[model samples]
Target: MSLLEQLNQDMKQAMKNKEKDKLAVIRMVKAALQNEAIKSSHAELSNEEELTVLSRELKQRKDSLLEFKNADRLDLVEKTQAEIDILVDYMPEQLSEEEVSEIVKQTILDVNATSKADMGKVMGALMPKVKGKADGSLVNKLVLQQLS
Candidate 1:
């Protein structure tokens, strides 16, 4: 099933099971997906698009968690982190740093990226292949390290 369909099914199950935390997170995800669909003229989102949405949501949660901790709001931090956990359930398995480095190394060579000036070329070649499976910042860092 598509990610959105799976989310809808899970949302119903969450409601039936009285899983408030799971239900709330699922609802938030559905809303974001729906918003994206509407914005994109009702086209169904590709898996890549779905991953993009989830990544954005996860990042927001992580940012909020940090802010909450800084403000000594453990309650909010816990809540936001729970939401992040739920969102992460649907993401592709993250690649290890070593695996990412291997791919980055190959990409750099593939694109003939010899210097900092070729960063864009390397990143453009790498991001699509690693999308959803690796963190963008991490991949960028590896690519830079290899180039340097």
Candidate 2:
């Protein structure tokens, strides 16, 4: 099933199961998907577009989780982590750091990226290949390490 359909089904299940946390996260994802569709004037989003929205939501949760941890807000940290876990179930399987490093190495070779100056060129080519599979900051760090 398409992501949206799966989400709808899961939302219904969550409601029936009385899974308050899961239901809330699923609703937030749906709202984000709807907002994205409205912004682009599309009747429906492609799976790739939907994945992008999911990734963004997951990233937001991770950032919030970090902040909550720093502030010692254990309750919020636990809640944010639960949301992250829920969102992760819908994302593509993440790439390992080793796999990402290999791709970045190959990309640098493909682009003949000799120095940090070509970072942009390397990143432009790499992001599409790794989108939804790897986190951007991790990829960026790998690229910088490979280039330098």
For residues 16-131, write the lDDT of model 2, one tens digit per residue: 99999999999999999999999999999998899999999999999999999999999999999999999999999999999999999999999999999999999999999999
lDDT tens digits by residue: candidate 1, 7-112: 9999999999999999989988989998998898857988888888888888888889999999999899888988888888898899999999999999888988
How many clashes (backbone N, Cα, C below 3 Å) per candidate? Answer: 0, 0
Candidate 2 regions exceeding 4 Å error are none
State model 2's lDDT: 0.96
Q: List the residue pairs that clash in candidate 2.
A: none
Q: Where is the poorest 10-residue window by lDDT in model 2?
A: 139-148
How much lDDT does each candidate structure score? Answer: 0.90, 0.96
Clash count, predicted structure 2? 0
Query: What stretches of model 1 exceed 4 Å from their correct place?
Result: none
Residue 21 alpha-carbon offset, candidate 2, angstroms? 0.6
| Error of model 2, residue 31, in angstroms | 0.5
